[model samples]
Target: MSKAAVETISGESLSRIVGAVVGLAGFATAVLAGMTTTNPGSVTLGRALICLVAGVLVGRLLGWGGEIAVKEYLERYRKDHPEPEPPAALVRLKQKRDRHEQIVEEMKKSA
Candidate 1:
């Protein structure tokens, strides 16, 4: 991925990651819940599979929304706190240019 894409956290990657995490959590939860019951068989497995699928779908949606919200918040934050103008290096270069001009003018006057 490009630098900008990596830095901004694309919705696709975020959604997938969130979906996988939520699906795993749901699966684990379902399995644990089933363990408490007297019959931990096909029904438990079915429930776990359903939970995993549902969690992934829901989590993906949530993650996409979260990515958009974060992007918007970052945009607003960047707008509010703008970068400084004439960076330090540029300011130094301008100062050096002014000094060189002054020296050349002084040399011309002396000649």
Candidate 2:
């Protein structure tokens, strides 16, 4: 697909976006649990909000990164596999051009 179409694949999936955000939140919360000086079994609203915002930023980054990686991989695969030939009309046109070139060469030879 073209660049614009590929962009749609990255940002258009609600499920993927939500999944990334939730996954980031879980990971960040775990890290916070270990790194924070706060007491166990308690979280302040401000801290919680900070985590939420951080998760969202990281999640968006993760989601976009994943999509770009997949797209690049698929593009590499496509380069290996190669696309189908051009359409039938184009094939016919090329054949006609070749025949015309042959006829022109014959005329030049006779001349």
Candidate 3:
């Protein structure tokens, strides 16, 4: 619910999208390379499938790398803004605790 949590979730989602795109691109590149470099006699459906799978795997790896980069960025941001604590459920809990304490003190004074 907090901005920090939102940012973290958004970053992760963005990384996944980037990864999928990269994988598709790698697949295309692999197909193209296979078509251009291999002999006509060597070309086969099985070989093409293998190339495609390999490309996708490479793309996924790149995507994971992207995710790591985003995580690093977030870590740096957290380090820089260490003061104003991230808005979270804990903040609300603390607020409630403080109000309860105040009420208890008032009741004691009245007694």
lDDT per residue (tens digit) for residues 33-99 in model 2: 6456665434544555566666776677766677777778888999999988899999999999999
Model 2 spans > 4 angstroms off: 5-11, 14-43, 83-111
TM-score-sorted candidate list, best first: 1, 2, 3
Q: In candidate 2, where is summed lDDT lowest over 10 consecutive residues? A: 1-10
Cα lDDT for residue 50, model 1? 98
Clashing pairs in 3: none
Quick one: best lDDT, which candidate? 1
Residue 77, model 1: Cα distance from true site in angstroms: 1.0
- Structural RMSD, model 3: 8.9
- By summed lDDT, which 10 consecutive residues of candidate 3 come out lowest? 1-10
TM-score of each: 0.66, 0.45, 0.43
The sequence of per-residue lDDT tens digits that candidate 1 reaches over residues 2-103 is 223213245446767887899889999998899789765898999999999999999888777776776777788888999878889999999999999999
lDDT of each: 0.81, 0.68, 0.64
Cα shift from native, residue 87, model 3 (Å): 15
Candidate 3 regions with alpha-carbon error over 4 angstroms: 1-19, 30-44, 82-111
Residue 16 accuracy (lDDT) in model 3 = 50
